[model samples]
Target: MTNFLERLKSPGDLKCLSLGELKQLAAEIRERIVETVSRNGGHLASSLGVVELTIALHRVLETPRDQIVWDVGHQAYAHKLLTGRLDRFDTLRRLNGISGFPRRSESPYDSFGAGHASTSISAALGMAAARDTMGGSEKVVAVIGDGSLTGGLAFEGLNQAGALKKDLIVVLNDNEMSISPNVGALASFLSRKMTSERFVRFRTGTKLLLGRIPRFGPGLLGIVQRAEGSLKGFLTPGKLFEAFGFEYVGPLDGHSLEDLIETLENVKRLKGPVLLHVLTKKGKGYPFAEESPALFHGVGPFDRATGMVKPSRERADTYTTVFGNTLVEMAEKDERIVAITAAMTDGTGLTEFARRFPGRFYDVGIAEQHAVTFAAGLSCRGLRPVVAIYSTFLQRAYDNILSDVCLQNLPIAFALDRGGLVGEDGPTHHGAFDLSFLRPMPNLAFMVPRNEEELRRAMVTAISHDGPFMFRYPRARSEGLPLNGTPEPVPIGRGETLRGGVDGVIFAVGSMIREALAAAERLEMEGIRLGVVDPRFVKPLDRELLVGAARRAALVVTVEENVLQGGFGSAVMELLEEEGLMARMLRIGLPDRYIEHGSRSELHAACGLDADGIARRIRKVVGADTPVACTPRARFTRG
Candidate 1:
């Protein structure tokens, strides 16, 4: 009941607490986590699950010297609290506050930066190798979840770490799920090893039998370990790890503080690569989270007492919902249409699609590279596969997209969701580079939808197109328009002018259209009349239309949600240069630097991409002073 969490300033302070007190600290930590997360909205369940493990590790090891790398870093809230960040914990995920994930630049205790999963092992191994080279003795450990192991990179790190035979400790935190339930062969193997009753009995009996063999029991057991390797392999999950040259140590009780501290102390003294397999509940302390961990995985704010999220008054559907609904509708009409996601069935809004047509749905289990190439394979067999993934995650499969899809000119529909500043997920998840990276690939058509209608139209256009096609939508809600259900194909390389003016023109794309129009409305009050154009396609650049618009206006401005470098604005400038038309131009978008965590509106304002910011920038381009008294028309909301 005492404020133990407030008193503890550093990991060194944890050394003074008794096992009972440490257990108490774990409870307090979980309470604090739930309280903060209920208001702030963050990765809650994972953080709650790892409280004990986090305490145990800090208790047993000397941190800041002994490195602890967390895979994905979403579950390190307890670690953050113990390491001098408790005071700022309230500001988690807010703009300019402490990050939800680990950042090496933010704190020295954070040994490595992580937002995405499955890179912990490699980073820890590298640190271990570096320590060895310098002739130093600081323990290095990587705490990885079972879900993170689903990635190929984790195994790649394991392979190299095993071969190197360096002193490294890997903590495999088995929570039976990632963001969603675990899938694939690795999940099956871990599950089989954990649940086999016969294997558990046999393993226990063999160890007891070996202990009873007089004076020679210990030495003989050690020597014949490999001779009995087959039997042990059949009986334990750790046999696979043993083969990789690691000293396999667990199947431990992760919730028991005494057992965890004791086991970690033992493993800390061992030499060479060691792996301690820990079993923990995904949402341990909280009952509601325990019942449905997936819903609480990366949750929005909720009522702490009832665990119920307040009903949102937003009547509009998000872009993801529209995509999912449209995809199912289209699939009903076209039997050849199939959907794919990389273990993000619910997050990607394919839950309805999966329930309606299970056979046509494929969840690839966090393997984006495989998802893209697999979609290509599906295309080869005359089936149309649409890969719906977050723009940030899709960066992982760029090679496959370029080689297997674009190079081959396959009919794969790439539906990129979360295509702009994803807010609280931060720089790691912001889709700032997709336009720049995706523009150069040959035989690819790029489109950014202005609203729900345009998104549906683009979806239809992408599905019907012969070559590789990409359409991106932001992470916010749609325009709340009534359903038309008709799929109209937008003419390629052409822009539609929404408002006409003689002084200047504003070219807007995707989510920025509403803001651009609002800025134009504000500027009109000051006698600065500006025209607006919606260039639906980013790749084709709409050369003729854009050049003609630029030539007529004294000033031209391009607005997008993407970064300035090699973005839609760059495409517009290059087109103007080609036609030898020189005009005063300004590009309004995200800055070259990585945008930090915040609400989308706050980030938009910070980056000068919001309506007021855009209006000021436009007024500066022309020689018009700010209006003294003006009532701009009702703000332009998307139709």
Candidate 2:
């Protein structure tokens, strides 16, 4: 058989293919996705689930002219394949390659960029409004998942889109899975197994039957129409969307290209906002993905045949694993310690904790804003609530964190995972701004742990603290250091001297400490003595240690994994200025631009956060000729 996928140049090419040919093309797309993802690693199950839906949409709609905004964009792999990116599909999620999510700059066909969820409907509505204003004849559609509907943002968008009644089509792809199995009332509502198409056809046929029965039929038909609204509400999921001022249609098979194409063609001509509910499996084609959809939701490179992930060289426990184990251990001792996550039970390392303390655990779906305020409410009721969320996702609840938690001085412990340069997912998923944003918030204690043991202690300290506390950790594996005794809370606003030197001092935060120690060791070999200090808390500086180190040294360096602007480095600079220290200072961190997707080590090296990069920068500043081999170690004198 000829390769149908190879013949496709653009979405317009799908228009020429017959229905049988389209089904063949979908199989080819799935094969290509599985082959590429097996080597490159990406969102596997979600993409496979939406292959037919993507192909049908492309076949029916004139894209670039007719905009289709995809929610989250992880499931857009099939969309990417159909839309002129077939050749570049192998480069998915690689450094300097095509993005894993939709990017507007990469292609005109990608109407809007998306990485985060629940923004598609709002974005598509804006595009529809723009098209109306410009008097353009373009159609606008927002392809959102049932899981994304759990977020409040999707409802907010729906509320506005319904009010305006714009010429838009919102396709709700009901696969019943996000990162995990979806939660909350919205999931239950969408999961109702009522056949909406059968009911809709019955309603249509009854209306025609009633209209044809002379004078008495008109009055009877009017009464039945009014009663039909109530009957439809009781029988189908469409009632909820119909109440939102949208013309509700379907509960149709998303895998059926003919049905999808026909429905999409009919809906394209309709005025005002219309919603098409499409039912699809999370992993449609691949048997491995279909069996375990959540595991394959976002995956690493794996064995195509066995579905086993490729093992890394580093066999140490991941920071996520350590955090999960530690949290479970702590929760067992304290009943008041309740955990809350925004639909990230597995991702945030809280799976075991949830299992152990089922009543105390809460997965609040994709609503981050609600999760923060809800944790605050739990704290107010005298519970030690720990909000376990990714650093990037927590940015959505900044206001809730500042006003509801910080301003109220609630004792909420925030366990921020993925605190540094997250690999492969790119700028949207990078936790580069947490330090900068959270630093200025009052009544909040911020901690950064250097190793797995420190992470355990930090968790203990944050839970025990009176005010709101937050600690951030990276996405990498933990240092294989053995955990000693029970975790003990370290002294707040204090730092420890790892290596002592007279030439200069390097204040390193979190994962950067490892790089700092390596750089110090390399400099020591070069006859340049550079001290390394682990400043545990970013908000509360170890004033005495820092001042004394600055007084004795001619040069000082601050290193972090966050963006340079308003970050840990900036905090150190402000401190030195306040103390009136006369030391030449250097800051090493990510630059004030979005870093591209790559391995954590690659990103660290690119941003000069790696040990070799750190050493090269220090050597440039101190001059390569300076010999400090005979210099005495600077003794840290406490104030």
Work out the TM-score per prediction. 0.90, 0.92
Candidate 2 lDDT by residue in tens digits, 1-639: 989999988889887888889889999999999999999999999999999999888888888899999999999999888888998888889988999999999999999999898999999999998988999989999999988899999999999999999999999999873322232223233323222455556767888998999888899899996785665554447789988999876666778776677677777767799998888998789999999998899999999999998997898888999999988888889888999998888899898888988999999989999999999999999999999999999999999999999999999999999999999999999999999999999988899999999999999998889999999999999889898678999788888999999888899999999999999999999988889999899988888988788777767899999998999999897776666554578899999899999889888988899999999999998885443322232452325
Query: Scored by CA lDDT, what does every candidate get?
Result: 0.86, 0.87
Q: What is the lDDT of residue 71 in candidate 2?
A: 97
Task: Estimate candidate 1's alpha-carbon lDDT, on a 0 to 1 scale.
Answer: 0.86
Q: What residue pairs clash in candidate 1, if any at all?
A: none
* lDDT at residue 541 of model 1 (Cα atoms): 75
Q: In candidate 1, what are the lDDT values of residues 1-639, reduced to their tens digit?
A: 678898997899989998889888999999999999999899998999999999999988999999999999999999999999998999999989999999988899999999888899999999999998899999999999988887878988999999999999999998883322232233334433533455547766777788789998787777666665654455447788987888776566678787677667767766789898877898799998999788889888999999997565788998999999999999999999999998788888999999999999999877888899999999999999999999999998989999999999999999999999999989999998899899989999999989999999998888888989999999898889997747888765566888888778999999999999999999999988899999889988788777777777878899999999999999887777656566578899889899999999999999999999999888876765322221222442334
Candidate 2 lDDT at 586 equals 86
- Which residue pairs of candidate 2 clash? none
Candidate 1 deviates by what RMSD?
Answer: 7.4
